[model samples]
Structure formats: C-alpha cells, structure tokens
Target: MAKAVQKIKLSPSRDIPLNKLVLSQKNVRRIKAGISIEDLAEDIAHREKLLQSLYVLPILDPEGQETGMFEVPAGGRRYRALELLVKQKRLAKTAPVPCIIGDMGTEITAEEDSLAENVHRVALHPLDQFRAFQTLREQGRSEEDIAAIFFVSVNVVKQRLRLAAVSPKLLDVYAEDGMSLEQLMTFSVTGDHARQEQVWENVNKSGYDEPYQIRRVLTESTVNASDKRVRLVGLAAYEAAGGNVLHDLFEEDGGGWLQDVALLERLVAEKLRTEAEEIAAEGWKWIEVGASFPYGHDHGLRRLEGVLVDLTSEEQASLDALQAEYDALQAKFEDADELPDDVDVRFGELEEALAVFENRPDIFKPAEVSGAGVFVSIDSEGRLSVDRGYVRPEDEAPAAAFDVERGTDTSSTEGQEAGASVQRAAISVGGASTEPEEDDEDPARPLPDRLIIELTAHRTLALRNALGENPAIAFQAVLHNLVLTAFYRFTSSGSCLEIGLRTPTFPAQAPGLRESVSAKAVEARHESWKARLPKSENDLWDALTALDGGAQASLFAHCASFAVNAVYEPANRYNQGRVSAHGVRTRLDQANVLARAAGLDMVQAGWRPTVDNYLGRVTKPRILEAVREAKGESSAQLIDHLKKADMAKEAERLLDGSGWLPEPLRLADSSPSSAEPEGEAGPLPEFLAGEEDSANGSDEHPQQLDAAE
Candidate 1:
C-alpha cells in the first residue's frame, strides 16, 4: 500500500588533493566550540588516514568548466586540520583527502549540502568510545599511546578504559539503558566481576541502586588511607610491605583506601613497639605500648610533676629575635583586613618557630624516672604520643615509717614515757590522746555541740535565701568550689553549696574520642584558662573576683562542663549500689537539657560510627537499624545477609558521614525519653522531677536558676 522510496543519483565520491581543496564560505559553522582545530590536526596526524569523507563542490572557471579544484562545505574544520599538517610537514601538500563531490545538476545547493552533512551525523555513544579505546588497549596500544593517538589526556584514557573494564553484564545493562552512565562509572572503582555482579544483584534486590550507594557497597571492606593507622605507617612503607591500595581513577579519592586493614594495624603496632623500645633507653620503669591507650588508663596512678627544661642563652636569644620579628610584622599589618599571601605564610612560619621554644619537653629527674613509666601510643593524628612520668601504685615510694624517739630522756621511767608521748604527738595527728592531758580548752569554754548545730542551722537557711537572691554571687560560689576540687589536693569550702559534680573519665577509649574536635576544643579552652589562673588555690578567690563578668561566666561554664555525664551505661537492678536504674535515666535526661542548650551536634563534634567504636560492638540487628535510619531500608537490606562482623563492618562504612547517632548519643528537643517504657527505671527522681517547677520558683527557693547558659 506504500509507494517505493525514491532512488536518486548520489554525489560522486573521489580522492581530492589537499592542495586542490579550499574552505567553502557556505559552511554553517562560525563560532568555535567542541574540539579545537589544533587537536583535530593532531588526531588526523596520529591516524595517518582520514576516517570521514568531506562534503565538497567542484570549483568552476568563468567558462563553467571544472577547474580540477574542490571547495569543502561541511568539513571545513577537517580541511583546516589537513592544511595545518601540510604546513607542519607531517603530511604532503598533495596528500589525497577523501571527499564526496556535490553534483552540479542536483537541486541541492552547496549550503544545503553542508547543512545536511553536519545535521544528519550521529554522535558515537560514550560506551562505544570507551569500548573502542579498550580495543585499542588490547591491541598492544599503551594507555599513553592511546591518549596520544586520540588527542586526549592519559587520565582520560585510563578513566574510559576503567569504564570499559566494568563487568560485561553491567556493561550490557548500561548498553541496554537498564543502568545509567554514572552507575557504570562508579563500577569502574572496582574490577572484580564477581563482586560487581553480586553487588548489582543486591542493589537490584534492595532497590537502592544509587551510584554512591554502589561505591559504598563495593568499598565497604577497605580501610581509608586517611585512617590514623595508615597515616602512621605511610603509603610508601605500606606498599613496600606488599599491601594493596585501591584507587578510583575518576574521582578525588583522598589518596584512596588501604585494602589490608589488618596489615596496617599490625604495622602500626610493630612501629609503636619499636618506638616504645627506643623510649625505654631513657630509663623509664616500664613502657606500656599500644596503638592507642584506654581512656582513664592513668587513673589512680600518680602523674609525676616534671620540670620544663629551661632554655639556654643562645636559644633564648633566637626566641627573642623571632618574637621581635613577628611582633613587628603584626604591628605593620595591624589595620590590614587581609594579609598578603607571603605575609600570611611568614606569620605561620614565625608562629611555628616560636612554638618550638615555648613547647620544650619537660625534664624528669633520674630518681623520679626510676619509679615512673611511659605510655607509648599513636595519637589521633597518627603521630607518636608519649605520655611520660606516670607512677603505678606499687611502684610508688612507701610512706615514711614511724620510729622510736632518738633523743628520749632515758633518765627515768617518767621521762621515757613523756618522750614517747611527745614523739607521738609530733608525728601523728587527730583522735583522742591515749593519756589525759591537762585541761586547756575546758576553761576557754567551747560552745556546746547542740548549740553550735542550732546556731549554724539558722545561718545556713539565711545564707541559702541570700545566695538565691543574688545569682552572680551564687554562680561565683559554685565556681570557686569547683575550682578548689578541680585543682587542689584536699579541698575544703566554707560555702554550704555542694554541687559535687564528679568529672567522670571514660573507661574505654572508644576509638578517636581522645582527639575528637569537641574534646580538643574543650581541652584547649581548659588549658587556656589554666594558664591564666594563679597556681595556688589560696589566691583563687581573689583571682575569681578580679575577673570581668564575661570571664567569670566563661570560668563558670568551664567548671560546669565537668558535671556533664552523658556516658551510656545499662541501667538495671544489678546496677544498684553505685548506679541506680532511676538515677542513670534521670542523669541522662538532664544531660539532654544541657545538650539542647549547648546546641551540641555529635557529627560536628567529630563523632563517626566506626567498626571499633559502635558497629562492631552492637548486634547485627542493631547495626541494620542504624544503617536503615541513616541510609534508608533499601541500603540496610543490602548487607543484611552477611555475618555479624562483616555486616557490622559494612554498616559502619554506610553509616559514616551519615550523622546517625545511637539513641543514647542522640539528643531530643523539649522532652527526651517520652516514648521510653514506663516503670522501666521508675519515675524520674524527685530532684529531677521538681527541676522545672523549681526553675519557675518553688518552696525553699529550689536553688538559683542558671539563665539558659
């Protein structure tokens, strides 16, 4: 029923000499875009042959006869490239350029011919180009050679090769439009066809087949090169030791990932032990070595006070000169809103040079070193951390012994007894005397116990009322007590207020907590304040009063930070004696209020879900729950079939940077634990329950309310 397609005479194809061809003005291309003529020229030279025919018209003389010359219409760029090669002497001027000669008798104009040739051309698919490059590679062309031949960068060639090297099944999926080019590019991150296919099957089953998720699944088992252990060992040493690094060809991989985590950890431990052995030469009692020390490992052990080694004359002179130069530069740039690059860099150099002198290591006496040990470990930055001069209980010097009086009278029994009594009184303290003494305080007439208690009781109540009325004084009083407890050995405060907030240290190090951004910030703040404070506790009261209101508030906050105990410990009947179930819950609930006020973000605080810190410690179900909460149910199901350890490890990779915190570490606004089971830990403690009502004003003026600080 359909008419047959028209059969028309086609243009004659012929080989025209480059010298006979001239660019036609009828060509539609004007503005420069896509590939440059220089690159096209290089490609033509590299190929040694033209791949496509140019559209051309026969040049005519005044008599309307062929002049044996051709004018290119659509392929002007190609003509210019060939002309360039002739000029460069890479190709002969008379080289034959294949072209289609436009028929003069045809209805098509030269302009129409040019437009049709360009408009009707179909661009090669990216996959086809990749496969082509792959073919070239397989045919003994090196990546560099392919790059040179194609007029592209070597990395570009490598990326294309990687994409081509993806699993054949995946490539087919891509070719069939079942998957996207982006997805195929991610597959280029790995070369294991089986693993890639397995991941693809999982991705299909889970329906979370995003490119990033695919990359996560593929690289979950690998260790980040930025990992402290890898950084400590270094890439060169790791590679030299026969460990593999998986690098992504198409992305900024941050130095890629170290595949052998166990090997990395082993290297870290061995290096740490070697460092410890070298440190042993310094005469420490013992050197405890580890990749990282447990939090509170130094607890109960007395840290030795080592004196900073004083600078020599030459060192002092150098430090002074550096300081002078730095100060002069600062004064010169006092009004500068932004320093010049060179000036800024110089400032950093000056600061580091000065810090070297100021941060000199402490020198411990040989006698003290004999009783103290060193803790050799890697810090969170992957640098060797040496915490020296810690004395264990057993290694500590024994208490001074009590002995007989050397100059006892020895004249008579009465004198001997008196000498013994004198020696006991001099060496010992407190408790009732064994023998009665002559009454000295009875005549002075001390107040009766009941009378003293009664008199102080009224004063205590009045003091409480007065303290509540003046928040500033109450705040200062609390700070003073905290300061005494924090810095003094034996603290006794006349103030009746008892915050009794014990600063609890972590029992487990929990991976990177020691050097977390928040922890480091808090420690830096504390150290700055400590440096500004008077060393003696006796001067603390005067110093506290001397500070400005802002400084006073800051000091109060620093003291209050010690009271924050957000550490998660299971609450149950067995947790009695020390941590009651109710008490633990109430403490955490209060911590939530504080957390909300502080606008605390665990993610910004450098808390990440890692295998060592969280995932490895939880059950498989819990791991899936975390992943599901962070990356959706589809992602969670992707690794659900793996063993607990493997699942946890993979879940850790998925959860990293997801900013997902466990329930204990999570913060809720307004009311936390509202959905928690009732009677699980009984009602909130009376003090905690009344806290809100107290803030609004209750009986006994329930402590001064901190104004949302």
Candidate 2:
C-alpha cells in the first residue's frame, strides 16, 4: 500500500590540504562584520584546530576532470583563518583542514547552501552567553582572558558578568522578555535578591517603572557619597562608623551611595559640634551650630564690621608670579582651538595658588566678638560657612552689663557655699520635653507667638520705610482706613498700616532662590535705600521730607510691591479664618491686578524651564501636558513612546522658546479666550484645564490686562 523509501546520496566529510582550499565567489559574505579575521586566526593558532568543518565543493575544468582544489561555499571565515595562519607561518601550507565535501550532483546551489549555513543556525541568547561567561569566570578565567577569547573589550566582559550576577528570578524575567536589558541593569545596582524582587513588584504595582525609578527605589534610604551632606561627613568617617556602601558597576555612580543615613547624620552632627566648639573658643556669646541656616538668619541683628587680614609679603609675591603665569598661558592659548593639557594643568595650579591669597581671614575686634555670636553652618559647597559678628537684640548691651542684669541665683557657689551643698540636680535622660517654652518676659502668655512676631517685625520695619518714602501715599492710606472704619460696620483688619510689607525672609523657597533675579533686585534696592537713609531713626522724617516728589513716588512703588502675597496657605483649606478660602481667592485676584499694573513678566524676570527648575522633577503626564500646551499634541505624541526621563528631556527641548509657563507662574490674564478664530486647534485637555484653573488665578481676559509678555 505504501511506496518504498528511496535512499539519497549525502555530502562526504574529508580532510583537505590548507593550500588546496580557496574562497568561493558564492560564499555570500561581502561586508566585514562581527569578529575580525586576525582574532579568529589567533584563536585557531591557540586551539591548533578548527571547531567546525567547512562546506566545500571540488573545482573542475569544463572536461569534468578533478582539479584537486576545493572552493568553500560556507565556513569561509574558517578557511580565511587557516589561510591567515599559513601566511603567518603559524601553520604549514600542506596542513590538513577539516571539510564537508558537498556532492556536485545536488540540486541546491553553492550560494543557497552558504546562505542556509550562515542564517539557519540559531544565535545564542544574550542571557545564555552571559551565563557562559560566568561559567568561564568560575572556572578561573580572568576578564581580560575571556575578552581576548571573544575579541571583546574587558569592559564588555565585566558588564556581562555583572548582568550574570543579578538574581536568578530577574534573569528568568529577562529571559522571558518581561523586562528590558536596561531595567535589568538597573536592578543589578543592588545585590539583594529580596530588594530586587521588591523593586520589581513595586514597578509593576506603580506602573511607572523606568530605569531611574528602579534605581531610586533601590537607593531611596541611601545617601549619595557625593552629596554635600555626605561630603561634609567624609566617606572615610562613615565607613569607620560601620556604614555600608553600594556600588554601581554598569554606569557612572559618582562614587556610589552610602546606605547608612542615620550613621552619616550622627557623624555630621559630631563633626559640626567639633567645629562649633572651635568657633566658640573665639569668645562668641553663643554659637548656633546647624547643618544649614534659614535665609536671612541675620535679620533684625546688627552685623559688626570686620577688616580682611592683610596678606604676608611671601604670599603676595607668590600671587604676583601666579597671575603672571596665568596671563601668559591665557594669551598663548587664546588663538588655539583648545587649551593644551599642560597649559590647562598650569592654569589649575595657578588658581589654587591664587585662592590662598584671595581667602584671607576677616579680623574682628575682641569687643565685637564678646558681644556678638556666630552662625556656624555648612555652605552649599560642603565647606564650612561661618557668619560672624551678629549681635542679638537682648545681647546688644555691653556683655558685662548683660550678665550683671540677670541676678545671681541661689544655686550659684557664691550664694550657697556656706550652707550644706544643695543636692546635685538629676541629669535629664532621653531628651527634653517637646512642650512649648513659656515666654520669660511674660510667663503667663507666649510672646506674640513666633509667626506673629516674625510677621509684625517685618511689617513694622517695611511700614516705617514706606511712610518715610511716600508721605503722600501714607496720608492717603490713613485717610482711606479712616473712611472704611467710619462707614463699615465691622473690620477684622490685622493692621492699620495699609502700606506694603516686605518679608525679612522666605520660610519656604526653592534651592538657590536667594540668588534669583527678583531676590537680587530687591537686595540692590534695599542697599541703595540704606545708603541714602540717615543713620539715626530720629532723622528719618527730615530725610524723607527733603526727597523730591518723583523720588518719593519711585520709592513708594518699590515698597508697595513687597506687600503682594498670593501664597495659598494650608489654613485656607482647614483652619480657615485668618485667611478664609474665599478671602485667599480674592487676595490673589487683587494681587493679579497689582501685577498687571506693574507689568510683571516672569519670563523676562529670568524664569526658564530647566531640568532643575521644572522639567526633570515632574511626572511624565505633567511633562506631556506641558509639551502639548506649548508645542501641540503632535509634538507631544512624538515623545510619548520614550520613558519618563527621556520624555521630560525631549519635552524640554521642544517647549523651549515656546513661552510656556506653569499654572502658578502664568499671569491671571493669560488664559485662552473664546474670541479666537473658529475651529482653532490645540485646546488644552479638560483634565489639564481643570488642573490649571485650580492652580492659576480666576478667569481674567488678557485684554483686561496689559500687552502679552
């Protein structure tokens, strides 16, 4: 019933002489790729034999007579390797090479056979290769040796090993293509399998898994060794305290992360205390030692003047020589495309030499040091920043008088020595109670609460300045208050002075906000006023009366600008009365009116969207919204496929110069209008619009304000 199976002829395997073999035209491999021929030849020389046999067909003349030479259809690389070995005298020309001779009577052509041989074989999976490298490493093969065998860089071998060292659970996930290689690499930053699995679970649960997020989750409790705080507490000190550090081998880690934050903080505090003790040795009345002090910590305190100590003659000579050298190097490199290495190194040396001369110590008088105190803290650069010579209000009097004013207590040795020594006070264990301290001056009541004290302090000084500068505006403000009091039934106004207010310090702000353009402008204005004002407060009125009308008006405007505060405090949501929710809303609307009158343009005020400022810190959705608002949906779509970090970066580039602003920074009057041409595209999504409205001021038309910024 069934046909008999036919026997088929097969290719025969044989050993062919190296010199008798030649590369075939139908070999198909043309462009150079993968491993180099030289490395392959070296590999063969080391092994002393080929691992795979070449597929070859015997060449013949038109007469069908054997030419005794073979043409390689497949395994051309192996043939080339042998040929290279023979040429290099590493092998004999007559050395036998392994070959599989294909029958000439076959239907398949040489080119098809070569293509099939090259393409049909399955390439090794990356994970399998990684495991193979790991096995070799375990067998005592060095990274360099492995790299040499594979014709790869040592770094590549190290990277594969690092990947192989990851948890088997994650490796299986990677094998199944559930996670990307980059994400796998991120997981490799930490060695704990539990942590790796935990982070993976968190990634799935959060559904915001990016490589950066994985890294952040893995190192959340850890502190970066390069962080200023960590730098303040040296890594050596942290390590000496038994703190552990995790290293990232696959990427630049900036010296890795310290895992013990509490230990680091303790070391930092101890070091700071030591530094504080040294500062106290200078006879300061008090030393407020802290990791960081609030901006304007010196507010309301008198700053004593100090002179810079003069540089010694030797130092002066060194500075002069370094300056000369630096100038010569700069001139020499000015015409060149880039500075030479030696010249750049010389410049660095010169800078270091010059810094010693530039940072001469400031010399304060002994009397000032006795009466004043110092703020011993760390600067942004991780260096100690000593703010000296601030005299607190209570300590303004002479030090002797200040101490004498507080009567001697019964506990003093002078008063109690004659009597049986009082029992020594018990040491307070743990820490002091967190209960609020009662006011010393008024024991029955807290001294106008801290916030009120701060607020009134700033308001009082600012009102004084405003009244001095703008007598006309001050009189009008008084009249307006009187009119409101006489005409209205109730008034809950906190203060009678309706003049502008200037806060002495911002309790909350972004990093480096003190260096912002607005902050600098205010500082410059304050300095200018301080210079012109009479030294004595008694003479302030006379000085103000002498000012011209234009000058008074200009000063009045500057003072009034400071009173604007549209900050939406949490009280508006809960505690409510000091600033009611509706009142806060109304306040913002009025503030917007003031801003429009003043022609405030935040962009021109030096606010731009940078990674540090806006882009890199927000969510991907928020970044997309920003790009959509600034560039349009199509542009937003172009980067939708990227991860959060990459999307944020790309969005920053696309939105640059598009004049986009976050809702809080956007002017109240800049809201889109209905009067534009019909069918105009690019309307913000409803969800984003709701978010913007809640964050931004009320609906005010652009035409209601000044021209667009």
lDDT of 1: 0.65
Candidate 1: deviation at residue 587, Å?
Answer: 7.8
Candidate 2 lDDT for residue 267: 75
User: Model 1, range 1-709, lDDT digits (tens) per residue?
Assistant: 9999999767779898889999999998888877889999988877788888898888899999999988888899899989898888899988888988888777878888778877888999999999999999989999999888777899999899999889999999988999988778878777789999999888776554666567777787777777666778899999999998878887777788777867776677677766765666666657666555543456568777778898889988999999999999999999999999999999999997997787676899766665567776666667677788888787654531111123332224433332332222211111112233223224244323222222222222223323333445556656655676678635322222346654554422334434445555655676788899887779999999999997877676665555344554444677656556665555456445544545555555566676655565555667776776666666665677776655765666556566676655556553221222322322221222344532432111111100010
List clashing residue pairs in candidate 1: none
Estimated TM-score for each candidate: 0.64, 0.69
Q: Model 2: runs farther than 4 Å from truth?
A: 4-10, 216-226, 230-258, 334-337, 398-517, 524-709
Candidate 2, residue 411: the lDDT equals 25
Compose the digit string of candidate 2's lDDT tens values, residues 341-423: 88888888888778767766578986566667776666666776677788878876665455545642322332232111111
lDDT of each: 0.65, 0.65
Clashes of 2: 0
lDDT (Cα) of model 2:
0.65
Residue 635's lDDT in candidate 1: 67
